[model samples]
Target: MEHEDPLVTAEWLKENITAPDVRVVDATWFPPFLNMEKTGRQAWSEGHIPGSVYFDIDAIKAGGTDLPHMLPDPVMFSSRVRKLGIGDGNRIIVYDQFKFFASARVWWMLRVMGQKDVKVLDGGLQAWIDAGGELEDLPPVPVERHFTARVRSDLVKDANQVLAASEAGSHTIIDSRSPERFSGDAPEPREGLPSGHIPGSICQPSGELRTPDDRLKSADELRTLFADPMAPTISTCGSGVSAAVTALALARLGNWDVAVYDGSWTEWASDSSRPIAKGAA
Candidate 1:
C-alpha cells in the first residue's frame, strides 16, 4: 500500500492552497499549564490559512472517557472530519501554532483512522508565516463531504500492552517527556499525577528530535537518533500528545511498527498498581 509523505513544506502548501482535493487544517492547541489567552478556535477566527478548517484536538476526543483527548471511535471520527469537509480522498495538511507540539497528534490520529493522505506542516504555522504565506481571518464555508474511518489498531496502544512490553522486554518503550519530568524531578503538568516514567522505558524528549526552528532533522540524523532500527517502539508522553512527535519522527525514518500509549504518564502514574521508575531508565 502506498502512503503519504507524512510531512509537507510551507512552499508546497502555499502553492497548492487552492487545490480542490487539498484541505488545510489548523490543529493548534496548548496544554492546560500554558494558559494561553486564545483558544484554538479563537486563533483560527483571528487568522488562519485561506481555506483551512480548525481541528480541535481536545474537542473531538472519545466521549465517556475521562482521559484527555483520547482517540474517538471510528464512527465519531468519521463524523467529525466529514463535518470539516474532509472526505476519504482529500489530501489533508495539518499545522499547529505551537511549533511541533499538537500537529503531529492530529497527523497520527488521521493516519491511524485510515486516512493515509494526511501530512503535518513542517515547522507548523510559524513556518508558513516565515515563508511569507498569507493568513485569512474569515472562515471558509465548508461543503459537506463523506468520510470513512477504518481504525489501524497497530498505531495505538493501551496501558495493558505497555505493561506487557515493559515486562517482556521484547519492545522498546520510549518516553518523550522532558528529562526532568522523566526523572521525577519536575512536576507533571497535570495536577495530582506523580512524576516519573514507566519501568524499562528510555527517554527521548520530543523537542530533541526537532531543530531550533521546529523543523524535523534530516533522515541521517533521525537514523542516528534512533539507533535500534528494528525494535518495535511504543511511545509515551505527559498525556499522549508529545508522544505523537516521537511516533512521527520514527515514521519519517520508515519505521511503521511503532505505537503510542494513549493514556501515557497520566494514566500510568494514576494507578499505583503499575510499576514506575525514577531517575534514569
Candidate 2:
C-alpha cells in the first residue's frame, strides 16, 4: 500500500486535528549529550497540541540492545502503540518539539511497521505556534485499540548489512552526521567512541535538507540535493536519530529504495574492527 506524502503543514494540521480517525502525536526527543534542560516528555507535559499523545522513542525502543532507541520487534511495537490508542485505521500526524528531529524517526518506525497513513508535521511544534495553533496542558485520555504490526524488513539495516552495502559496491551509504564529526575532526558526543564515518560513505548532514524555519525543502530542491537518483541508499547518523531525517527527505523525493542503519555511527565507531573513513566522507 502507498503512504501519504511524508509531511503536513501546520495550517493543514490545525484544520484536521479534530477528525475522528486522525491521531496527532508529539514524538519529541532529545539526546542527553545535547544538554537540553527540558526533555520531550517535559515539554509535552507543559503544553502540547490539543488531543495529541506523546510517543517516547527512548521508552518504546527494543529493550535488549545496547544501542539507543533501536527498533523494537513487531510484537512490542504493536503492543505499545496500541496502548497509545493508535490502530490500523488511524491517520497519524507526528511532530517533535525541535525542528523535524525525532518525529521522522517515529514516522519511519510506523512505516516499517506497516502503517501507511502516517505523516510528519512539516515545521513541527514551533511551526504550530508560529501558525497560531492552540495548545493545552491536559493530556488526552487514552482509549485502548488493537494495532497490527507486520514488520517490513527492507526498510531497516544493521551494522553488518551496512558494512556489506559499503563493500558490495551497489548501495550508497549516506552519513548524516555533521562534516566535522564525519571527518574525525570533532569528538563524538558519546564518550569513548571514535569520530569518523564508515568507509566509502558520503556526508550529507541532515540539517542541510531543511530550511531556515526548519521545515524541509521542496521536492525539486531535494532532487538537486541528492543529485544521484539511481543509487539505493543506507542512511546513518551518530545514533540512528538524524538518519531518519535523510530517510524522510529521500521518501519525499519518492525514493523508497532506502534503508536506515538502525545502529548508525554509535555502533560502527564503537567497534574497533570496523573500517573508519575520515576527511570528507
Candidate 3:
C-alpha cells in the first residue's frame, strides 16, 4: 500500500468530514500541572468538529502499569477504538485543542497499532477555526466499526530497549523535552522524579518542530533540525506524549522508521538503577 502524507490541512478535513470512511478524532489533552478547568472531553463536548469522536489517551491504555498512557495490549486497543467507531478502511484525522500537541500522540498510537491511512490535522482545532470551519456541540452517535489491531512492535520501544540504544548507541535516542528538563536544569513536572536525560541522547524540543502558527515546519527546516535524518531513531519525552511530536516531525521528513520510547522520562527516571546524564548533549 502506498503511504499517505502524515498530515492533513483543515481545508481538506472540512471537505471530507462527512465522508463515510473518514473518522475525525479529537485527542486533546493537557498535563496535570496545567490544572486546566476543562478536560479534553469537556472541551469537545462544548464544541468540536461535526461528526468527530473523542479518544482519551489516558483512559485507553495498558493495564497494570503505573506508567502513564502506556500502549494497551492489541486486544484492548482494537476493542477500544472499535467502540469509538474507528476501524479498518477509515481515514482517521486526529487533532488536539492545543494546536499541535496531543494529536500527534494519537496518530503515533494508531500507526503503532498498524492502522494505515491515519493522519494528524495540521495546526489542530485552531487551524479548523482559522479555515472558517464550523464546530458543533452535539456529538454523533456512531455505530461500532470493526478495527483490527495489528501490532507493529518496531514502532514502540520499552525502557530496556531504550537502555540498550543508549548504551550500545545502536539507535539515535532523541529527547523531546525542553532543554531545561533535558539538561537537568529544571525539575520534572511529576513529583519526586529527578531531571536529566538518558546517556548519549540528543535534545530536540518538540515545540521547536512547529511553526508560530502551530503547523509543522517545512521539510528543509526539519532536515536541518535533524542533522542525520536517516539514522535509526527513538523518540522520548515526558511520559511518552511529546515523543510522538518528534516522531511526527521525523515522519514529515519522510522518515517513518522512528520508534517511540513509551515509558520515556517518567519510567526511566523513576527507576534508580538507570543511569542519568546531565548537561547538554
Among the numbered candidates, top lDDT falls to: 3
Q: Write the per-residue lDDT of candidate 3 for residues 1-281, one digit (tens) a residue.
A: 21556999999998888788999999999887889998988998999988899999999999998999899999999999999999999989999898557899999999989987899999899999999999999988988999988889999999999999889999999999999999999999999999999999999999899999999888888888988887999999999999999988888877888999999999999999999999998
Number of colliding residue pairs in model 1: 0
Task: Summarize candidate 1's per-residue lDDT along 39-68 as a digit string, tens digits.
Answer: 878988888878989999899899887889
Candidate 2 collision pairs: none
Q: Write the per-residue lDDT of candidate 2 for residues 1-281, one digit (tens) a residue.
A: 24446899999998998899999999989889979999999999999999899999999999987999999999999999998999989999999888777999999999899998899999999899999998999999979788988888999999888889889867888889889999999999998999988888999999999999899999888888786744798899988889999999998877765789999989998889999988984
Return model 3's CA RMSD, one decimal: 1.0
Error of 1 at 108 (Å): 0.6
Models sorted by lDDT, best on top: 3, 2, 1
lDDT of 2: 0.89
What lDDT does the true structure give each of the candidates? 0.88, 0.89, 0.91
lDDT of 3 at 226: 89
Residue pairs in collision within model 3? none
Cα deviation at 258, candidate 1, in Å, is 1.5
Question: Lowest summed-lDDT stretch of 10 residues in model 1?
Answer: 1-10
Clashes of each: 0, 0, 0
